[model samples]
Target: MGATDRLDRYQPLVLGLFRIVIGLLFTSEGAATLFGVLDRDATPAGDWPFWYAGVIELVCGLLVLLGVLARAAAFFSSGAMAFAYFTEHQPDGLFPLQNGGLAPALFCWGFLLLVFFGPGSLSLSGVFRRDAAPERRG
Candidate 1:
């Protein structure tokens, strides 16, 4: 097999790594918002959407990282990012650059991908035996 074939064989591992990185980034974002760390101001508790969104990010990010209920968590996370972009970022301008909504837009689409592709080789979902059960194609 050529290098391309070898690379294709490692797709699952690569996917897992991708998921882990995305999850880690998301979790960090939440931590920064909630704890005022990461050189960012903390969202005050009970703040309408920011705080709640932070909580979702923290929880869903961990879930995605762990590969437990990855799809559901990713779906929710994607929605949260979408909501963030529409309500927060899209307001300033239609373009992400103008509104500073790039991060949210990217996160939204990234999580949406997880919703379809699922966690990969490194996920705990397999060990837990609760991973997505694809219908038998026969």
Candidate 2:
């Protein structure tokens, strides 16, 4: 098969895997910041903004990982990452390399992509689709 055909055939699998990985990473960050997993410091539960953001990350990340409402989860995640980069990293400098904004920037764009493209064919939504069967002609 041609390269395009091969890519088309495998696109869903690749996209699903990508979504899983991204979700895992985002979830880990939330876990670390909220629950102190992976030897990372836990933000105080009562802390403002950071704690709230962590909650969002945890919940949205889980939704993304399970491919449940992935587009909506990814949309929220993308916005959160953008906010993080702008508020935390951009003050240091305009460039990501100079400001240590790479991770947030990547997450922002990655989630944005997922928001547009969805979780792909390997997702729960795909499996549970109400109209999965092809229409029949009378």
lDDT for each candidate structure: 0.92, 0.90
lDDT tens per residue, model 2, 1-138: 899997898888999999999999999888988998999889999697789788988999998988999999999999999999999999999999999999999999999999988897667877778468687899
Q: Which ten contiguous residues of candidate 2 have the minimum total lDDT?
A: 126-135
Best candidate (score: TM-score): 2
**Cα TM-score per model:** 0.89, 0.90
Question: What would the per-residue lDDT of candidate 1 be over residues 81-103, giving only the tens digit for each residue?
Answer: 99999999998999999999999
Q: Model 1, 67: alpha-carbon shift in Å?
A: 1.0
Model 2 global lDDT (CA atoms, 0 to 1): 0.90
Taking all chains together, the TM-score of candidate 1 against the true structure is 0.89
Model 1 residue runs over 4 Å out of place are 130-138
Model 1's alpha-carbon lDDT is 0.92
